[model samples]
Target: MRRLMQIACAVAAWASLSLPLSAAPTEPENCPGLIASRDALVSRAALRQDEVGLTFVGHATFLIETPQGVRIATDYSDGTRPPVPPDVATMNKAHSTHFSYRPDPGIKHVLKGWNPAGGPAYHDLTVQDVRIRNVSTNIRSSGGGTEYDGNSIFVFETSQLCIAHLGHLHHTLAPEHLKKLGRIDVLLVPVDGGYTLETFDMMEVLRSINASLMIPMHFFGPSTLNRFLSSAREHFPVEFSNTAAITLSRAALPKSPKILVLPGH
Candidate 1:
């Protein structure tokens, strides 16, 4: 009965948090001694353009700068900007959040869609030593103008960190999707729970990747966050930091898999 009560409390908390979104989410940008990227997105020069540490700006947007001066920004948005410009940028054909071609200019290379024009298509994006691949999603709409936006799952071969971004994911991942997304280190996921898929289905996809760190994004409210934590807590410890943001070094990775719930950008 005690465990049941705990679940009930968690459920109540979840119910209360489903409000609405008026602004982006953030943690304070100032932390003494520690290197803080001006925003979730930063110029390559910010980390001194270091190769390793990754900074998550928000939903589907990450800043990757290699030790060799190669930088790539993925899925930029309206108000989102890098403290410094990047070497490359990736956008999808999904929704406004995932891709805004109008906003992007002066990018070296751009990977267009999830897959090729035909079926079973694959997009291989390799730059220097880093690679970001694309796997088509089944998010299709009727001839009424809905579309199946092929979402791309990126991979950074240099770091051996395969990161999958469920760009407005609409269904469970198929076997092909799983096989393509083999061995992921970090996962950037949506937590509106139902808007993407049911909680259980989304959770199963996350489990399939078995990523070391799962960062929740596209969340609706605190309740959505609570629901996600409640679900993941059973399989992995959900670490809630009162922190503004976290900086990850390859050397500082956790032994056991951990889910990090970060504020959105």
Candidate 2:
């Protein structure tokens, strides 16, 4: 089954990266064919965990602590990881900011996107209640040249959260890219406004996908942030926050689309 291979591949996928071996969590069942998988449900990650919380360390970086005491981290940095090991960690090869490892003994699985031959490296796989996949988009170099670096979109099924991290995304999402994205709950988008792509092009990408929450990343400067907010505000409400981490649950999600901008800590 697709789920089995993905679950099995989950171990092998991120093997090339460096992280604490004990941080990976046990792969959930009904993976590829998650019955809970819904297409039009845009809800917050509201899974009630007895002793868990989610934290966003930085650009495309997140820490998801599940109800079973399972903590999954995304794009962990070597010197930036928490003192404790996460049950699982997801990383992309787009930039150095998205990958790192600590010599911890409590972590379990470390996942990385697969680089393709003459194409973007995309490591697409699904875990128990988690689905971590990638879409290959053209990478526009500083001057010229085109490098195909795969962009990964991680979907947390149980949380009803389909999050797409545009790792140095050069172009807009292709037809296949949208298909893979399914239904994005919270999109971790980059807001260079011009550096990455023209505001018009970026707007098209935002319009193409119907994600409930659009979380901006990759850009700093108050003006840059303001530009992003202004551009996105046309389609949805932009809510800024002082904290990067949010405890999301399905029942507590927004009824309409919203943009949650968490402060960079």
Candidate 3:
């Protein structure tokens, strides 16, 4: 009887060890839940016709509008607001100008990049025609130490396009980070020589991502923006737009990667 009891206890221990860890759930690049609802959502939004509109809102902010009339403001803060209230707003608290504590009550979804309680900030939800998710990255703290998961690279997927905004990124991306990003069609990046990654390092990141369209943001003025543009011209053809807004579609993407500079709002 004693031997049998020992055998039973050992089997129970082995079973527990074989069980998968449930403490931390792994978030996939393309969440299955978001895909599951696509059929229902896509059928309703006939206006998009496989295209989306992107408008530069200045100072690291861009307004993304989906075909189904869903609007999203990236890096939303007190400094900038869409002409009309956005259905969703994604903010990175890297600086006072990138995030606001008091957002308008009319805005529906407000996503923050940092987890104040000391964990990775996680956002994985779909609203209307746009599905939004985030990959957490570290930032430099005011005290000068590294703050882990202090920022997020927000990705918006809709109309078969993946748009990513690198919010206050300070370091080069790791292999793991790239894996989470998947395939990015359009990348809204910071071109400020010093505030974000150094110009050369930022260039390296741009090459690594190999996005089809690179939009410069967070630049103080034309001088810094021009410097990045000259370096980028080596790889991507530079195009300056007189307007702040541009409509994009998968079918109409440029044959090659290009750096598109848009007027700040």
Instruction: Compare the candidates by lDDT and give the number of the best one.
Output: 3
Model 3, residue 168: distance off in Å is 0.8
Candidate 2 TM-score versus the reference: 0.70
Would you estimate the TM-scores of all the predictions? 0.72, 0.70, 0.83
TM-score of 1: 0.72
- lDDT per residue as tens, model 3, 11-106: 332111100111112544441101101001222242345767777878988888777888899999997767677899998877988898889899
TM-score comparison, 1 vs 3, better candidate: 3
Off by over 4 Å in 1: 1-51, 79-81, 115-121, 142-149, 241-245
> When superposed on Cα atoms, how far off is each prediction in RMSD?
12.6, 12.3, 17.8
Candidate 1: give the clashing pairs: 17-223, 43-84, 51-66, 51-67, 139-148
> Distance from true position, residue 77, model 2, in Å?
3.0
Q: Can you rank all candidates by TM-score, best first?
A: 3, 1, 2
Per-model CA lDDT versus the true structure: 0.56, 0.55, 0.75
lDDT of 1: 0.56
What would the per-residue lDDT of candidate 2 be over residues 34-117, giving only the tens digit for each residue?
Answer: 111111111124334311244656555666655545566666666456546776776655566667745356667776553535
